[model samples]
Target: MPTLKELAKRPERLTPGHRLCAGCGAPIAVRLILAAADKPVVAANATGCLEVSTTIFPYTAWNIPWIHSAFENAAATIAGVESMYRAKRRRGEIDEEIYFVAFGGDGGTYDIGLQALSGALERGHRFLYVCYNNEAYMNTGIQRSSATPLGAWTTTSPVGRVLPGKTQWRKNLTEIVAAHGIPYVAQSVASNWRDLVNKAEKAFHTDGPSFINVLASCNRGWRHEPSETLKVMQLAVECCIWPLYEVENGVYRLTYKPKEKKPVEEWLRVQGRFRHLLAPENRHLVEAFQRYVDEEWEKLLKRCGEA
Candidate 1:
C-alpha cells in the first residue's frame, strides 16, 4: 500500500473552475474516487451540489464521461445505463468493459433516492454508488436530511426553546445497504485521504453493487472557517462520531480506530451548527450523544471481532 502522500499524487479527474464552495467536500471526494478508479468510467450524478456546481451550462468539471440525472433517480439511471451496456455486450455491439459510478448527496440517497438505491442493490448491479453525505440538503439551503446527526442545527431543525437542532439520530444508510447482502459496503471520510482512496479502489473492483458513504463537511452550512474542513472531519472520526469501516461479503471490519475516543464536544464546538449545544446544561446532552456513539461503536466492534 502506498503512503497517503504518494496516493494523493494521482491526477485528479475532477478539475478546476468548478463552482463548489471553498472547503466543499463533494468535489474533493470526487477527486479521490476518480483517482482510484484509474480507468475510464461513466458516472451518473444526481441533482445536488455536485451536479449544479460541476455543470453550469456549457462548462463542466468532470474529466470522465458523466451525466446529470434527476435528484431521486441517479441510482436507477445508472442501473439503466449499466443494463444498456450489458445488452450491447451480449450482441457484440461493444466489447469493452466500463465501470459505472453513481454519485448523490445525503438528501438524494437517504431520503428521496432510497427506493431507487434499494432496487439497484437488490438487483445486484455491477456498479459503485457513492453518497457524499454532508448530513443535510446543503446545496439548496441548510435543511435537514435523514443522514443529519442528532442535535445538529439546520434550517429545518433550528435550535429553539423546545427543540435542540435535529431531534432524531442519523439514519444508518450504510447498514441499510449492507442488509441487501452486497459484496462490499464501506464508510470513509475525506479527512482521511488514504482510506478514502483505498475504499474507492476496493469498491471499483468489486463485482456487485458496492456502496460508500463518505463524510463531506460543508463549510458554509456548518459555519466554519473554510480552512477547518479537514480538521472538522478529523475531529468527527476521533470523537467516534464517524467510524471508518468496510464490510466485504457481509463481514464487517474496522479500517481505522481512534487511539482514544475523544470527546464529542471537541467535534461539535468547531461548527456553528453545534455552538448552541455548548451551553453549560446542554453540554450534558452532547455527552449523552457521545454515549450513544460509544454504544454504536461497541456494536461495530463485535462485528469487527474486537469484542
Candidate 2:
C-alpha cells in the first residue's frame, strides 16, 4: 500500500470543483481508486451522481481519459474500450500500458446494469468495475434500489404505518459478482482509506475482471450531517453491517474486523433513513435487522475460514 504522503505526490485524476454534495462519499472513493493506479487510466462512468456532478456539459472534473455512459452499461462501455486497447497494442499501434476503470452508483450497478456487468465479467475483460453504493438511487431523487438496505427510508420505500421502509433486504452484489468467478472482488468503505486504496491497487493489478462494492454514504439521502459521513461509515463497519473483505482466486479474506463487534443499533441510530427502526413500536424491526447482519457476518466468516 502506498503511504499517504506518496499518494499525495501523485497527480490528481479527478480534480476538484464539481457538483457532488458536501458529504457525498462517491468522489472520495473515486479519488482514492484513481490515485492507486500506477499506470494511466481510462474511466467509463455510468450516468449517476458521479457522472452528472463531475462532468456537467463543457466542464469536467476528470483529468484523465473519461467517458460518460448511460444509466446502465458502464461495464460494457469499458469492456469495448479495453478490447480496442488490446487490439491496438497487439498491432503495435500503442506501446504504453493503460488501466481501465468503470464507476457506477448502486442504481446503475445493482439494478439497471447488472446484465452488462455480468456479461463483461463473463467475457474476462481486464478492467476494474467499482460500485459506489450509497444504498439507493441517490442521483435520481433517493429512490430505492436493489442495493438499499432493509428498513431504510427512500422516496420509493417510505416509512409508513403499513410498511417500515424497504420490505426486502438488499441484493448481495459483491457475492453475485464473485459467483462469476472473477479474479478479484471486494467490499470497502471510503472512511477506511488504507483498505480501500490497497484493494484498488490489487484490483488494478488483477489479470481479469475485478469488482469492488464501496459503501459510500449519502448525507442528503441518508439524512446525516455532511461532516458525519466518515463517522457513519465507520459505525457501519464496526457494527458488521458492512464488513470489509476481499475475494481473490476463490479465496475469501476478511480485510478488517472490529476489535469488539458493536451492535447494529450503533450504525442505525446515526442515519435518519434508519431512524424509524429505532422507534419503540418498531423495536422488532431493529432486532430483525440485527439478526440479518449477524447472519451475514457469520456466513462471511465461514467463507473466509475464520468461523
The candidate scoring highest on lDDT is 2
- Residue 282, candidate 1: Cα error in Å is 1.7
After superposition on all C-alphas, the RMSD of every candidate to the true structure, in Å, is 1.4, 0.7
Q: What is the lDDT of residue 178 in candidate 2?
A: 97
What local lDDT score does residue 172 receive in model 1, on the 0 to 100 scale? 86
Count: clashes, candidate 1: 0
75-161, model 1: which lDDT tens digit per residue? 999999999999999999999878999999999999999999999999999999999999999988999999988888999999999
Most TM-score-accurate candidate:
2
- Please report how far candidate 1 places residue 97 from its true position, in Å: 1.9
Q: What residue pairs are clashing in model 2?
A: none
Candidate 1: Cα lDDT at 133: 93
Look at candidate 1 and tell me the lDDT of residue 23.
Answer: 92
